[model samples]
Target: MKLRFGTGAILLLAGLMLSQPVLTQAQRQRPPEYREIMQAGRMEDPLAKIKAFEEIKQKYPNSVMMNSIDYLLVSAKIETKNSIDEVVKLQKDILAKSTGPGLITDYLTVNDQILRHKKADSFNKQKLVETIKKNAATGKKNANDAKILDSVPQQYRKRYLALSSTFDIQLATAYILAKNSVQAGRYLATFAKEGGTKDGEYFFRLGQVAELNGQKQKAFNNFFRAAGLEYKGADTKAKALYKKLHGNIKGFKEMLEKKLTELPFEPKHFTPKTKWQEKTALVELFTGSECPPCIGADLGFDGLMETFSNKYLIVLEYHLPIPRPDPMMNPATKRRADYYGAQSTPTTLFDGVNKLGGGGGKGNAESKYNEYAAEVERIIEKAPQVKLNVTAKLANDVVTATWSANKKLPNTEYHFVLVQKQEKYSGGNGLKLHKMVVRDFTTLDTPMKKTVLFNLSQSEKAAEKYLHDFEDQRGFKFDTIHNKIDRAHLKVVFFTQNKNTKEVLNAVICDVKK
Candidate 1:
């Protein structure tokens, strides 16, 4: 998709360029000249495209689309210029002006292009790798800045993460090409310790590192796993390595087939201690089924469930119609969103206050999972200050929840939620199954031991009314109706929180038995 800048953005760009003092008269006009930019992008011939883009760059020197223009111009030049030096110079110019994800992307592009140029001597390769590494460090620094990441639109976060992942793998390959085996192995070890990418290329690189370190058995195992993934020439390398290690390649193909059916490689991470925690951590995810960015957050939540037991963690997903209409949205879900003051999809709150916003696409799921896993571990280690428990039963379309707490502090509120264990819906975001969806909820100003009965039949009508009101208020259309309740698969959640501080004191989840 093409990124267009408005008058304000162009003016901001102009302000940032004022110190350059080399702006053309046309650039000083500060006009929105996106049409010319799009025209350049659509040019058929490479030379023509390069000329058009160069002209656009000269005319709209302060355009926010300067990055896009430079990238396109470089791409066109790659097709027309036979000199590797000129291509390298163009990429270097882009790298100089780029920051954040753009810098990382351009670095990856430059490094990959350099690698593909077989004519490049070792000295040139070393120089290029050094430049790329220096710029990659800068990109990482900029990306680590909270303000920079928050400035990015949530939907674009996925693309940024994917680019960063590719940059990381490419950086490792660059070190290996430079014959810095020590650095490559060190980098791969650190990445693995932090839960590295799940791609087969990672394992292939690990195999190379193992072979370099003289661990032939380990190298064979790594190559076998990489070959199982069928990544590029890993199968041939795995066969050759197996023949050298075991004196035969007879069982190599069989091993590869068996490994193919197994789960992908997962690096080991420190598991958090959960034996003595007094209260389980509560993680609430606010998401939209039609929102593309929520895919990573949704999958990350599923990973959290697999990684931690319910005795240590309890999770709830609240649906909202954000960026697009979602079928899973309802009144209670909207109310929960308001309670947390959540304004964006894929926003996750840990214990009510530690809010992590922005998620990416499916390719970014593993990164997001690692991020959440780290936070959950940190939060789980906190000493418990309150004790809460809850139980519930489902019978004749009625849910009875009994609750008790050690004590309730001032400005504290108790919340009871009915969660559907799982729901199936073919949503716009391509998610087929949604878990732990909030079907209904209620809040009380004070806490007390009592039995609350919820009639599913009445709640269903209320859900319909809520949907109708939401449609009228927002003037939005929903693609499908999803108010139906599945009583057979449901759970009840009880949580208490400080209304003023928004810290969840305690929480518990119980199955709704019929």
Candidate 2:
């Protein structure tokens, strides 16, 4: 022991000592490779982090990191697409284990998603119903099942209660789908009292359930209440449904009241006016064949025309230029449409007055037609405002018309229109059919205010200029308005009087179909 060692032996011992490795306490306590994935997620590259987490899961399947990796995957899926199918599966996977904090948030999120996309034939609905029933049974069995209660933390107890209320609402909806109004109504009442964020939907469900149960007044009340709520889509649906139903109910009551009120009233006796020429009625329909609803009104109008076919009842169909195929559309019609402030389809006029802005539907077409017919019958049987005498001639393509009123006219606008009738034309199924179309119109301008005499000399020149500009700008050729006698088929309509006053003293429908 006291003797000195050889140099070679000393060098070999030193080399062996240096070869052995040693680590500090701090280095030994460092986090594992899985932490890098979480760090990447905190740095905002969630997809990349997800991929890295998946790799960690593959490498260490049984490690504690697997649970967190699964949660992150579920969260990523939900955040990306607002989907909960994979999240629901993940929930089922961890249902046995006591999931840590934030588990309630996930559970509620998945439950809401299931309710949102539920369909009658979907497995999600069936699974949800089963789970709800199981939970209800278990809740009744053990009032203090820590396993169920602890699914959510104490800090999130209120959220769990809100979610429970939502579950009840969904259960009510399921009952509604099953046509069980009693259970649905009972649950709806409970949901309303619970006061959840989806109160609008709850009240709307209540209204629907009440309607199914034949409680109309209750349904209306619930619908009105739901409409007053702040839910976006649901509130709109409730309001629209309520308004429609209310309108129907009111209309029925008014009809009964009107019949009762009219029972005691006697019909007025018909008396003719002193001047027969002054009594004339004009019916202008601002319509288009392209409008489906307008077609129904047109059919009703056709029936009226066939029934009345008198010079006193002059019907003019002005085809408007809408974004659709309208072979009947003419410049005169568009001018008339613009004059009446008709921004909507199927506008109608009775005696130069706008009768309806947006005309009635097919269901109400017959009633509206009868209304107009009755008014015309009253006017023809009574006195007229003014008398109109007119003469029209076509030299080349230009039409010249001179009109004189028997009485002093009101300070109102008047228009002159040229119409054409089709005797034989190509139509549906490649067959020849007939049509009536307006060709041109002269704007309302008079040299003398409220005078009986008027001339188309100046108006004709302006109309020609306008037509020329229109054709040049729009690249569409139109039939000449200067002379029209050579066409062999044409009619002139002298529409005299004001639009706002509903005064149409005289109108004539001539058949020039060749």
Candidate 3:
């Protein structure tokens, strides 16, 4: 990300990197004396930048930079992954001196990063969680008061409200990351009790906590509840546990499914929109047919597609090699999984940024679907700064594609892919239909051209490979299974993403010629 720019270019770039419209006028101004130090502070290497800052501190103890040096020092320490205890002390010092309660969010963000460190256990988890609660409370109060809310700028106001809404979940997760599962459970329970989180994912988490605490009955109850809630991984694990504890619950799973279905699944709010790709959303589904935990993804994604077809949502279900093999599973699936850090079945990504769906069970399937739907609805409304002009055509076995932009794109990379609208693969779990299946990938450096060999028709080798994926997972419900690829069911999915940030800019589903 480093570029060698001249003096004028560097000055222009600095404006894009640092801004403080929310701060007071005086705080926003950079003193002339700190110019060289500021430039050195912007070095790419954290340790080298820290050395530059330290040099400034030693050279001018009485300088004006003294006032702001602490913040810079702390930022550097975090950038260098300094000791958690020392960083905690420095961050707390910054918080104590912070005149604005909302600024506590900066410290919380640093602490959250520190908490992510595997060996970072120096700070008290309880104390840190409490501080987040206090900040969240203050943020709520400030956001609710007309005068106080008006005093803050719009961007900071939005940030404060967002942090307030998310602090509890972040704090609970931070505790778990710090290896303080006991405190993590306590905070998560308190969060749920306070009506802070309602996603069925919380129930799966509670089950995990119960298991960690050796509360078998409580754990089983939570896991069992999660199974019917529209989470495949949780349901899979719950079913396994249920069978082990009380062999063949007969109609137990069926009864749970029936009851869940009987419940009214009404979304509180959703407005159907016509326009989709001003900002398109991608659902990267990590699943395998052999993995029973992926059933929820199958059902839930079906619901999503029903709600928003190729118009607003583009689905890519990657079959993985886990627990057992899936014939359609390929190296690309594993590569993408590794890139996304997906280690378990039923993991999904929204726009390659927000991750959702995993674990053994879902506490509420209908509710989870609504949550996902709401996100898509929100994305569908966003107006994009750049629009993608992408097209794909298939001829023989080779596919050619072109991607261009109306204007300069906002940090984007071009990706061309092949997708199947439907494929039939009945593995151990006996799934009959797999949709939005990603078949192949090709990368493009610009909005120019890229081509990849596409499998227009299924080969016997493909069927043989498919059979090999499930040779050991014996007794699939179907006595005879056919593995074939249908070209008529295929299309090309194109993606434009922030090359550095990994954010999807736009996605298109283009029909392929028969």
Candidate 4:
């Protein structure tokens, strides 16, 4: 009877141990460690924070604190050059655990960051909007819960009303993500009537809505109103845009007339030298083959290329791999897209100085493109402070590039870009497409001597050696590999910079096919 009682006691103890919730490493570890790492993250030492969070995650995968730690882990991963998909997957994992409000807010913030990183589509944007609305509405309905309602900001009352009235605006922006300008326009009109205010932001949003809807007159009017507002940033942007639009109509018409007669072979010859010229019109088009609206602009770009030939237009298409499969996407492009704070697809940047939504049709696009082109032409007319020359050569799997500039500028950041031209391939559209896509970009340090050479010969050789050794040793090949050799078309693009001011001095694109 004594032995049996002892055995029963042991069994009971085991059962209790099994029934109790498992503690994660984060739970087992000192809480001070987590606090320290979080503080480090606030200090911008993300790598340190990542190490701390990783230790917590590895030790305590089942702790209640794991949810918050996971969110931090995602942020740390993002800081350390990990893919947004990886960060998002972790967020989803934490969300599955039914975390609390703080964790939920962290999840939402991370989701927004990931969307900014990867360029969310219309469907994704709509899903996010719906989720936000649902959360907000649920929070509002549960106002009796002081704890929940107290967590919400007092400013949210006004924001909620604004959101309610401008729900269609959010939806329209989502449509812009979907590349459905027609729906976007309809929604924008609704938002303008219901939510439009005299605030600069309101007019700016209206202007964007009108621009996307292809209502140039309305866009101009809204922009004009926004420019007249007393706000600083919005007013400045509005004024610049207003002047650009005011001048471009006449300039584009003249260019069109000249093109009709001459059929210019290059952009340099066709571009006129005018005092209004700003700088190299750096047109960065964030697009994807899977997006329908992008297809229209893509066609328009093709036409522009044909008409302008090789003229002064330096267009770089950054294919954002989102919402659909895009094997051609480089991680660098996604990083730059995130850095530029792009929220949706079909976005364009002119001279890296101006950003425009890509919802406009042929007429609107032509006007805007021409306006930008005329500005570029005017800038080039004045002898540039720096003259850029680029040379590109590929040997085996290595690409080497050299950039030479004539004059140095203050407060600039230089970037070297590799571009490749390939034969057009299509998916069911029956139209072939030629693209000048960004292959890679290297951001340089402050103004060095005018000449810079980036040689990847050793790196290429090392990669080849590794691959050959792997095949010989294990008879296995990695599924992912990048060999920059054997590409039929290649180009080099150079940009001068003012590092202190973070401004681009000038940008030049050179065709290596010549």
Candidate 5:
């Protein structure tokens, strides 16, 4: 998934999560020269910034901030629309000079950019292919070098390992572009041996390579695997190939689903407990219907709901028309997204505080489920500061939700939301069913009474206006617009959270009674 920040600091190096290294006291206090060099990079004029960065490099030939300066200089040049060849050369030069942690970062950045540039018509394909081949050899060595791995922070070592495997896939892709399927297959084999990649694109490419090698069965299997992972066009290709091979696609989906289960990763299954000791945890997910990367997160959320009961875990999902318009998005969902400062899809907050972002393709659903399950399990162990109970009744096209907390602490807010049990929509993403989708909500800083009435028609009307305003702001119309709610499939969710800390003390979810 694409990682963007609003109120939190997080980084994703090609889908591998890496936390920022905590700065040491001495490193936090940088030299005056370092500040000046960084200031030069912040110049408004791109040309001037490039010049300043170049001059600073010359002035401080041995400065510890050389890597930072080099990155800024290259970024400034790119901002000026410099030729891709020139950018590659500059990045390669930096890679040649870098060592330790800088070497790994520069290596990954250089290879990744080169891989992307090779796709464009502007690049010198032959030379670029050679460049990647040479870098791949050296990068593999450096990645395994004890000194280089030691230089990276403990938290980032796994990310480095993941990057090395992804680089091998990039190299294989370059060879395939050069029409050298034999060499591509070799590198692809290495990638497979190294636990494979989370990216569906490479798997699709690998399937193409298998086809070129006349491995028909291998190609069919890989293509089906790619489709199951949510790679675009793979599904069509897989179905056509299945018909060609088996004379018909009688059990294509069933076979593919079975094959996906054979993967090394499996969704975590939790045993249901008959007793409770602490407050139930709430998992609020902010996602987009058109987001392809959110497939894994969406599936993971479904897995969690099936694995745990509402008595122990309450899950809420909010949709947004991010990157593209989503019919499921409502005004209340947008407000919750803005309140959390969520700028990316597939962002999950556990108990209103612990935020985890970034997701992969459908093939990664199980692993993502395990990742989320671990965090929710950790939060479930904590004691609740305040107990909460909620009940709802539907009458006369209106829903009355009454919630009460054992004690209301200062600066605490209570949120009441109406959620649809499930909605079926064919979005850009392949997900056919969305569960626990938030329809509308209301909040109180301090409630004189515990009962809140929600007018279903009014909420739908507000959502319709929100969708219209959304289209106006984007200067285009959505493919489809839906603002109606399934009243019969509605549920009520309530949670008590600290206004300042954004922490949920307790929560509850129950079906809306008729």
Candidate 6:
């Protein structure tokens, strides 16, 4: 329960097994052990699943299920709330016998594990250098291969490489920790060139590396870029660094003012132009915890929610690996992000048509609130077509949830999404307590307006697993969730989308009380 950073989370494999051959009735039924293993394969209580995997392994170490069960065990071990040394030993044992994607991914994670608990010994430094080299070589090969990845399967397209800063930042840190200044300088320079001028953190870090390497010109340029971004801390850091490196900082600040006018992102035209003004609006907020620019963007969105949510709005925050790994990273969220062409953190997709990128304008927080407030006011000016209501009740291990639509929708698809209102996991930027997180979702394709029932078992963990690519960074684990959900902050969101256009029509929220 005390797992910090990326602990106590494992990959859910239920959906992944679907890509293989179809299972017969008997094969599907299998045995009690298979059923038990599948039940514990989610994120609610990883310790329980870890124990289940251990039981299965002890009884049937040589069973035909060893390959599949071994994977589950490895993933569960990563998520187990145990000591770090114990984790290192277990990972080393798995690495000795594992093969294919599992082995490679485990190796990458294990390398980080070693780094996480590294000592001052020269031997530890050598091990870290070796691991860093291995992760880079393997990651590069996998990045270039056109085939489907066997380990992590997040996006089908090559768009994932766009978020390379996730690993690049960690790699550069490892080199710096090892005191390999030459390698650190080289990798950071390449990161700056390939990452371009989009991410402020990348530019800021590049400036630090450049300054350390005595590349004042490169450092000044990168620092100036960071100063133009929305984050005040990064802005201040860039200003201080610029002054340190150059005697006359006043001249640079003056020029930066003019340069920011012609910034990287132009004013995008994302005005809502729906045929019918819908009162109940759904905003798919795609964000990353580590992204500094996201701080302003999130604040702008939250401002709207604080005032407008009571009137008519349902905000669904989808966490993804934009600039870093987030505990709430889900395959479904990533797919939804890709579907909407969400390339960067703090990308807000409103009602599936109005897509806005970047944080709010560079100004005070109050001004930032006004920046997105107008958009929300426009969305809720009129009532929606369907008035959806949803509710959930728990009894023992069973969760009985029901949803109803106010109007008939023969052509629209209804999706019932169960969400965790808030969590205690603070991401890279110290933004803990993530809200409106998608725990699990169900869909009814092309359905008419009617009351529907959905049942969930707390013991079943595989019902909501979505595959995603993590680059060996074992993403936030757990299933769609059954019963281990924090009852206090649990809510259900109802969304109705057009079957043909795929545009979300309307949405409603119902907070559940246990």
Clashing pairs in 2: 396-483, 397-482, 397-483, 397-484, 398-481, 398-482, 398-483
What ranking of all candidate models by lDDT puts the best one first?
A: 5, 1, 3, 6, 4, 2
lDDT of 5 by residue, 1-514 (tens): 1111110011112111122255467755665577777588558887898888888888888765555666667756655543556767676565665656555455556665555442344566687678777777777777788887876767557656665676677677778767789988898888878865544666677788988887778888888877766567788788888988999999997877765444324545676343455588899999888997788888888888877778789999999877688988998998999999997898899988888776666756766787788887787777789888889999999999988887868888889999999988878876777889899999975667889888999999999999999889989797777788898899999988888999998889889999
Q: Pick the candidate with the highest lDDT.
A: 5
Ranking by TM-score: 5, 1, 3, 6, 4, 2
**Model 1, span 210-230: residue lDDT tens:** 787788888888777666645
lDDT of 4 at 313: 58
Error of 2 at 126 (Å): 22
Instruction: Please identify model 2 stretches exceeding 4 Å from their true place.
Output: 1-278, 323-325, 357-368, 423-435, 447-486, 499-502, 509-514
Off by over 4 Å in 1: 1-89, 99-168, 171-196, 200-277, 290-293, 357-374, 377-383, 426-430, 446-449, 461-479
Off by over 4 Å in 5: 1-133, 140-161, 171-215, 236-244, 248-266, 272-275, 407-410
Model 4's TM-score against the true structure = 0.40
- TM-score of candidate 5 versus the correct structure, residues matched by position: 0.69
Q: For this target, which candidate reaches the highest TM-score against the unseen true structure? A: 5
lDDT of 2 at 156: 38
**What is the lDDT of every predicted structure here?**
0.71, 0.50, 0.60, 0.51, 0.75, 0.58
TM-score of each: 0.63, 0.39, 0.45, 0.40, 0.69, 0.43
> lDDT per residue, candidate 3, 105-149, as tens digits?
443444454544444555566665555555556545644566644
The per-residue C-alpha lDDT of model 2 at residue 235 equals 40
Worst 10 residues of 5 by lDDT: 1-10
How far is 306's C-alpha from truth in model 3 (Å)?
1.0
Which candidate, 3 or 6, has the higher TM-score?
A: 3
Between candidates 3 and 5, which one is better according to TM-score?
5
* Tens-digit lDDT track of model 6 for 1-514: 0111332122113223423355677765556577666676754676777788888889876654565687667756655524444555576565565333333334444555544442412335655566656655664454444452443345322222432333454466567666666777677666656742235555556666776777777877777776665333555666666787666477766766665533333323333455445467788888877775566566565566666644366788887777776656655576677667787888787777776555522322233455566666577766677776677765564455677766777667787777777766656654545667766666765454344343444212332333223533464543322223565666777788876776677887776656
